[model samples]
Target: MEINQFLDATYLKTASQANLTEEETQQKVIELVKEAILYDYKLVMIRAIHIPLVKKILNEAKSNVLIGTVIGFHEGTYTTEEKLKEAKAAIVLGADELDFVVNYTAFKKGDLDLVRNEIIKGIKLCLDNNKVVKWILEVAALTNEEIIVISRLIKQIVFEDFGEENAKNVFVKSSTGFFKTKNNLPNGATLEVMKIISENAKPLKIKAAGGVRDYETALKMITLGVDRIGTSSSEEIIKREKNRNKGY
Candidate 1:
């Protein structure tokens, strides 16, 4: 397998959480971008604010690693207009892909229309700009039934509103890595969650994020038909692959 192509090296730490000043945070983003380029990862997923800096770094390095950013980030409660504006700005700054945190809270409240509207607007904006879009469902926050419902809803809406071909460019991503669970359980991609998502979201791709930190788990996700694996441990995973290749 072309493991590098399957990995989206990610670093989404903000200024405060990372305990860095704005300049320090920018430096960290640059380091992440450089690592992605050096390793030839499929993409570098960062916070939206660092898109331009990443774009500049990749351009200077003569790298083709795609640049991706998150919208509405860990929280999916942003107004649709706000999400749209963030998407537009990220694209203007050279983001090749946008991963949006879907309003699952509204969906859980039986407000499917609101959730649907936000997704439609976000997807349309990305498609119109010839960019890739992924909707993050934050599966840790949902029940099994909710996962099936929302996964099916996203696929159905994408296919019905845009043609099947356009729908192919969209992804049903699994997590945002920041969901606070009552049980304090893992809030990212798991085998069971990947199975549910893959089984429900067909034709449209799947991006497994959160908790996919090692080589073996990442390979398992790909085996389950995941199209992308988001991880901050891309280098470590790749190193493990190398060790295995050497008969270790």
Candidate 2:
């Protein structure tokens, strides 16, 4: 597949407090949106909290990408019910899809069924409310085996709820940015998780977030079948990629 095709889809992922004001955050998001359009990039995983100010950003796109948001983001402690509510609210505000954090600790504690059920519930809620879902496994917090299990179960659970064809919209993603962890596992975890997801979650979309910085890395993940990227490093990556293409 072409690297540009993967660039067609990505997330601005403004998970920060420094740019919190509605005006300031909207300015940042709009600038990213326009940057994507200018570079021929197409879908964006925008933030839910900033949805109210998304209109101008969405309108500014000449080759506008689709808008997405995160659920149980930054933390996976929220109940599946909370994720469902947030997803509904996001859908009402025009979210094309949602990136949900899976309760990995709960799964590690042997509540595997509960984790799967919760994800299925969230996806059901989104579909019932007319939206799509991207389930984040947060690989930084999971073992490689657990990652495989979660990726496998996500595909199974989504199909069980929404049927095979509709399951196409259900994605598995890495939200490894919760906190800086020891041993540097979370740092390059997206690549490893993408390998497992690409191998196990056949035909399912995979999103890579946290720790992505340059074009080569982005291109590598996309080649491994990552459908979208979540990054705060868009400016640096785009410019560097452009310069590389120009042989600079």
Best by TM-score: 1
Q: What is the lDDT of every predicted structure here?
A: 0.92, 0.72
lDDT of 2 by residue, 78-168 (tens): 8878877887888888887788888877988989777877887888787777776777777877788988888888887766667888757
Query: Which parts of model 2 have CA positions greater than 4 angstroms off?
Result: 1-5, 8-16, 19-23, 60-63
For all candidates, the clash counts are 0, 2
Off-target runs (Cα >4 Å) in candidate 1 are none
lDDT of 1: 0.92
lDDT for residue 161 in candidate 1, whole number 0-100: 95
lDDT for residue 210 in candidate 2, whole number 0-100: 79
User: What's the lDDT for residue 208 in model 2?
Assistant: 81
**Compared to the true structure, candidate 2 yields what TM-score?**
0.86
RMSD of each: 0.9, 2.7
TM-score per model over all chains = 0.98, 0.86
